[model samples]
Target: MTRTSRRWAIAAAAFLAAPVLAGCAAGFDATTVKHYSPTEARATTVRGIQISQGFVLGPEPGGKLPKGGSAPVYLSLTNIEQQDDQLVGVAVNNAGTVKLAAPIVLPRDKRVSTSGAAAPGATPTAGTAGPPLVIEGLTKELAGGEYIAMSLQFANAGAVDLTLPVVARSREFATWAPAPAPTTQQTPTTGPTPAATATPVPTATATLTATEDASTGGH
Candidate 1:
């Protein structure tokens, strides 16, 4: 074939393949349906203590967290001030008491978080940092996509009020641990067992015979 004819044939083949590739791409779209955002967690600045990425891990998808149960919370704290601070407690109205796995100490200009990583370039302290905060003894059942009012109590920073979202245990939070279910302790049944009734024993009577003496006399 002539060079001109060969070039035209190659162009025709390339033009024909373009529509097929486009159709394949259209059929299998690579766009994601869900996305992870830092804003999904609540963030607020209280005095010099900045709390970020705060959210309670709610029930599994389409499930309800039972009353008197517990839920786990994740949050990051940054101490922007010069002094250190301690997170002593957290309170949720009509929800539950916040339980800290360990004492959380926020060093000056450093970060500590329950999500493991404290900040962008900071590592959590070995023994004294990075403890999970949990809500125990929930007063009411909770579903996902709900909001609850919470208060964080600090040793020096005082208390900070927050409204945190209850994120479901699916998608980005699927890997995070949920709060342990409440265990029911069975109480021992008490009462004295009825004593077995005692039975009466009959006494046997002994009979004595004197006729043997008369036979001996006859002999």
Candidate 2:
């Protein structure tokens, strides 16, 4: 009822609400946002090598990566070992060949990524600084949102198998570049053709008879 009592009640209410507002702010912190978190890309660790954001770039929206065709691969690798390593090979089931543009050299404690700028805040490295991964001659058709069996080999780290997901070229993946189409090589022709030979003409011979003229003179 008094003026001082009313003021004291208002101050107490403000003090109590501050803590609740602070708790709510922490609940919605930007760092906790889903976009800032790791994506749905598959990840695994093998022999101290960390592979993340590993996926196959599937066909365009409403399309499928045709059988006997090709698709691009995107991933990031971090070598946690002291010595360097190299990605020597890659294989996919129902796929003919998984081609790496160059030897992916994983420097010690460095990160290499094939997805080119997909990994946020990833630094450049000998392996990640170059071209993309391409899987050619797919034996089976692939639509988006599917997983395929795959294996990766390292010179020193040995081989690691994975079930990599095939994602459509939409949303966050839309900005990521796709692997270039496989080049078609023509078969070379055989040696030049042989030439035809010509036949020789027989020589004409003419014999003159002088004996008839001599007989006429004698007569």
What's the lDDT for all of these models? Answer: 0.74, 0.73
CA error at residue 195 for candidate 2, angstroms = 22
- Candidate 1: 10-residue stretch with minimal lDDT: 27-36
Q: What is the C-alpha lDDT profile of model 1 across 1-219, one tens digit per residue?
A: 999999999999999999777666653322122233445578788899987678888877778888888888777788888888888888888788888776678889876767654445544534532237788888888776667898888889899999887877887777766776556999999999999999865433222234556667889
**Shift in Å, residue 107, candidate 1:** 0.8
Model 2 ranges with Cα > 4 A deviation: 1-38, 123-131, 184-219
Question: Across residues 22-136, which tens digit of lDDT does each residue of candidate 2 receive?
Answer: 6667653221221211345777888988986688887667778889888887778888988999888898877678878776788888777776564775654344433457888
RMSD of each candidate relative to the true structure: 10.8, 11.5
lDDT of 2 at 204: 39
C-alpha positional error of residue 23 in candidate 2 after TM-score superposition, expressed in Å:
34
Candidate 1: segments with Cα more than 4 A from true spot: 1-36, 116-131, 183-219
Whole-model lDDT, candidate 2? 0.73
lDDT of 1: 0.74
